[model samples]
Target: MLWIPIDRSLDIPLIRQVYQQIRERILNGDLQSEEKLPSTRELAFELKVSRNVILEAYDQLIAEGFLVTRRGSGTFVAKGTFLEKRVVPNHALNWRENKTDAANIIDFRSGLPALDLFPRKTWAKLSHAIWNDTSHSMFGYDLPEGRPELRQALARYLLKTRGVACHPEQIVITSGATQALTLVSRLLLSPNDTVIMEDPITNDIQTIFKTTGATIFPIPVDEYGIKTALLPENKKPKLIFITPSHQFPLGGTLPIQRRIQLIQYSRKTNCYLVEDDYDSEFRYEGPPVSSLQGLEPECVLYVGSFSKILSPALRIGYLVLPLQLIEESRRLKWFSDLHTPSVEQLILARFIDEGYLERHITRMKKVYKKRRDYLMHCIKTTFSNEVQVFGYSTGLHLIVEVTNFHFSKEKLKQIEQCGVKVYQVEEHTIEKDKHQNQLILGYGHLNQEEIKEGIARLHVALYK
Candidate 1:
């Protein structure tokens, strides 16, 4: 007699359980070819399940060619039904065991906004209104270029704020700046193509471009941004990636002279400049810096996202591409995920149109400014002349260069064990050892108390 186990405690249907067990046995070669199965009535009687359950299971197996029956004979396992099972390594178990808990540590990582300050009430109100009045067509797939409503609103806002000049037709909505860079790499790069980028850029950006199999020509940046004079004259790169308004990790605004040089170089070489204008709106100094895109819209592919200004969770960013690349970009975007979520786009469109986004940024600017000031004050009091702060005029994070000190891997681990976490500037540098003493400390998400305690702990970790 062929026996199959049944348990009443399981939520699965009796027919499914029976079907799965028999299929597993057949696939594992436990039941050989042409092996006879017990009659449905006998199996149902033995397993204490309904006859109909056994009949359904057998019928399904027969339909799937796992079982066959003769005119007057009972069911038999089909030939060639067995398959060898392969073992998959449990990599996630090791990763989970080694993961660090963030709750206990005062983390000062960059690019994180204050989640508590997000305009939740306004967003909820707009979301409710949008869903209530949404058109039937919105339930279907949207254009790959994104909703024109949001694009139009962004075009106007970018023009007024960042001096970016473009119509909604040039804008292609993306999941975030990461996706924008990925798409740009796909559009402009081929294997072994040359590209130029800052030496100490965000590691994620470096990884994105490297995945395209392009050769990255690293240009060193200073207090003013990328050294445009260092750009290779003989090399004709396909793309030049930059963070002009505020350089990542180092936080230097590219000067107008360098900006013009970049434009001239791109035009001469017929290459595209990808301008990432991230977190330029929160400049604490004079007026927000005008984008490199506005200088030469034809040569620049402008990338902007709400990830830094508002919240990263929104996953809404856009690329203001040159007119020539717009169609191909739309096609590539369609091939990638088939468009960003439509409902959020509609809600954000309303949010921007009603001046809520501006108001929120205005409010957060003051809050972030205060936090930035407090963090600076705490660092000054704790470290005194031992550290010099750089790039505090704009953006959410600033660089602190520790005098005559290098943040080695062991030192960083020691700092983390002391209940504080900080990022090393060397982590973002392509040619390391130059920025070994500098640390990128972000203050946008931290409160004054946490900032004070974190600095105090860091001081002890460094000096002790």
Candidate 2:
């Protein structure tokens, strides 16, 4: 039987869901070429749906060439519909799924928020209200720059929270920072154009630039963020991608002087600065760091996402672009996916407007701070002076450098075998053999007890 689970609670229609699932199975080879599909009557009986609904779904699929029917024969998979495997790049090998004992493992993976801390009840209320009352006109395509309400809500929110000066017209909602970077790469970069990026940067950013055929010049990042003094004096790249607020994998916030120098460098080179303020909501020490875009709105393209603060599953992010790049970015985004879903956008906008977002951030910050403190305590008690932590007091994760331990492949595998998972900063490094002794421990998603136990297991794995 071709089983397609239909959720009655979804806003999508039952017939559309059935059609989409069958089409997906055909495309993915789950339904092989020439495979017979069950009759509409049998499928209707099996799924407990109306026979007319099954007929409608099948009619659409057949009309779309995903299915075929003959007088004497039943429906079958289309002949040319078998998808061939395409070659993926070597860098994508990191995406291979790890088969682990899920019941006992402790994960310290980076880029995850504490999902347990999200305000699910409020989100559900907003979601239900939005779905129930939204205009039927919104069921169709929306503007590529996103819904006006969301952009406006984000404009006021950014001005108050991040000190970003932007009109709603300049904000383009993206799937997340990933798509925002993709849009920038597509719009600003040409083949062989030069780009300057942090050496130990987010792997996805590096891959995005590489995929766009940009010539990447790697700059070493220190404790104070990307070394502004080391920026090329003679040549200039089209863009400089940076994480100024609590740098990724290593926690260095660019100081005011460096930020000024970077803006100056961008101005001199006639280039743009891509400032990714990914996890700025959980600042634990010192005053909140202001965004570089606020310093010089004309020179910096600021990107932010809710994935770090609220929930990654929401797939909501925005780019505060300079006036010059606005049109092209929107055109590219339109060609990419038209726009993010309108219902979710309205829900998030409401979330911001109703004060739930702020309250959630304030509550989660304290929770994460406690987890951070407990993790630091455990690391101190376990490794003592043998370990040095970086990127502390901010962000969901911190870097732990164990002086005597080298995270070679074998060592990492051994640690994994012991049911503890911690990521190495060296994996994100562009220059080989740097930061090999450092590991990134993400505490946002784990409780204090898990943090202590995970570190203890890691300690045994490394020491034993």
In model 2, what are the clashing residue pairs, if there are any? Answer: none
Candidate 1 structure quality by residue, lDDT tens digits, 1-464:
77889888899988999999999999999998999999999998999889999999999999999999998988999998999887867884565453456787999988899999888999999999988999989999999989999999999999999999999999999999989999999999999999899989998899999999999899999998999999998999999999989999788989888999999999899999999888999999887999999989998999999998889999999999999999999999999989999999999999999999999888988988999999999989888899999888888999999999989999999999888999999998888789999999998999988999999989999999
Residues 1-464, candidate 2: write the lDDT tens digits.
98989899999999999999999889888998889999999999999999999999999999989989988898888888878678999998888776878779999998799898788899999999998998899899899999999999999988888899999999999999999999999988999999999989988889998898889898999998999999998877999999998798799999999999999999999999999999988999865688999999998999999999998999999999999999999999999999999899999999998888888988988998999999999999998888998789689999999886789989998998999998889898888798889999999999988998999999999888
> Runs in model 2 with CA error above 4 Å?
1-99
Estimate the Cα RMSD of every predicted model relative to the unseen true structure: 2.4, 7.6
Q: How many residue pairs clash in each candidate?
A: 0, 0
127, model 1: CA deviation in Å? 1.9
Q: In angstroms, what RMSD does candidate 1 have relative to the true structure?
A: 2.4
TM-scores for all candidates: the values are 0.92, 0.81
Question: What's model 2's lDDT at 22?
Answer: 93
